[model samples]
Target: MIEHRRIAHSLVWSTVALGALALTGCATTDKGGSSNLPTPDAYAELRDARGADRGRVDIFRDSSGLRLEVVARGFGPGTYGMHVHAVGQCAAPDFSSAGPHWNPTGAQHGRDNPMGAHHGDLPNLVVESGMIGRATLHMVGSRLTGEGGLLDADGAAFVIHAGPDDMRTDPAGNSGGRVACGVIATPAG
Candidate 1:
């Protein structure tokens, strides 16, 4: 039973969600460098677009890292193959049943392989039908959130494939079909 929540903002949405979670959780700036992060309008605004198969994925973290913003719609335009697997249970028809890819640094599977894979091997999402298929993935060498995350001791899930992550496949991105999914909870910043 892993449950953590904390999104109640009031101080101007908590100073714009803590300045977009300190520019996507990269907050270390004291006149250092690499600090222009701020983009989390709860996945960058894009209200329910008439159930074009539904969409709205917003996962956040601060100190400058981990950000997702899949705001799909009707799923139609191009590219899909997304990643972030490793259980959260989204069973039913075809959520690929949600179960693999959140490789907590076991590392391998593309990004130029070395064997050890799975860090939600992301790279493929372009939807644009009625207009909504947006993606803003950025987990490069991630820790996920405010305290070293892959969901900090038990938490993670976000899959949406069906094709396009041929990032040198091994555990995923043979990208054929998994359709849609989401369960990256544990943020309340």
Candidate 2:
């Protein structure tokens, strides 16, 4: 009888340990449907021309596509054009150092263009009374890693323009001057 009691106790403890391990495995896979991809592969810290912290952008990779989460503040209330520029530099005031819009496939400038749009053209961002806004954008032709990734070679940048993107013009959608900029890079582990 003593030996039987000891075996039963050991069985109960083993069952409890297995249950705990299963629960932990489920918790780690709760990232929507991205069970196979890394949560956030890259990040960008955005700033105004004065070099003050505006907000940040996080890039995530999943089986469906690439996801970009942009959060920003401290601008005047209005709609602004935003895009990924070709270069990584974010010189103050004009931000010309960031170069033109990212166009890896050599596509045209706007989403409304018949020839096709540039890889960097994103939706317009609207700021409310407190000058704050956040948006999540998804893309099928881009990724945060390898080959034509946003962090490739010359790198890329997020840029905010003074005017709205007309969605049909060439070169830059006549978005006017760049108001804010941020360079995209892989976050340090």
Candidate 3:
């Protein structure tokens, strides 16, 4: 039963990903100069320090909130910490250019902390054998462009850590070094 459910879920996400890919080339802005709402969709191509393709991240906005899915490959099998960084720049080697975690509300790190669980806090990502990992249906209850929303003037990014998040440590949940990074941006950009 669990296997069946997993298959169904994978199929659903694959379809949605294909849909996003189909609309990737379309204009996301009010290009015609009409009263069209801005499409709050974005994508990111993850890369390792050596500039190799690590995977991709797709973010979709809905009425309730934002949904993000991460598909990763070519990494060691282990649980790793993931978060949305404040800056969009994902410089190679260390990716410190991505800046700190997105915390508009000034909350601390980790969901397990009493005074924490900031906006950028996300569930840990687990990679299994064959260098495959998928973190699907991560709901980020934040807007794309608005007060306290992501994609600010500095933009945002997603980072994959070298170790699992302790889920209680301040600042970074005691997660290890960053292994992969991706700059989040609209497909049209």
Query: Who wins the lDDT comparison?
Result: 3
- lDDT score at residue 60, model 1, on the 0-100 scale: 65
Point out where model 2 deviates above 4 Å. 1-39
User: Model 2, 23-88: lDDT tens per residue?
Assistant: 766663322343544556776788888899887787888676678888887878888899999898
lDDT of 2 at 112: 91
Candidate 1 residue lDDT tens string, 54-136: 56566566556666767666566778777776666555556554577777667777755766446678778876576457777
TM-score of each: 0.27, 0.76, 0.77
TM-score of 2: 0.76
Error of 2 at 153 (Å): 1.4
Compared with the true structure, the alpha-carbon lDDT of candidate 3 equals 0.84
lDDT of 1 at 6: 39
Better of 1 and 2 by TM-score: 2
State how far residue 18 of model 3 sits from its true place (Å). Answer: 21
lDDT measured at residue 179 in model 1 versus the true structure, 0 to 100: 65
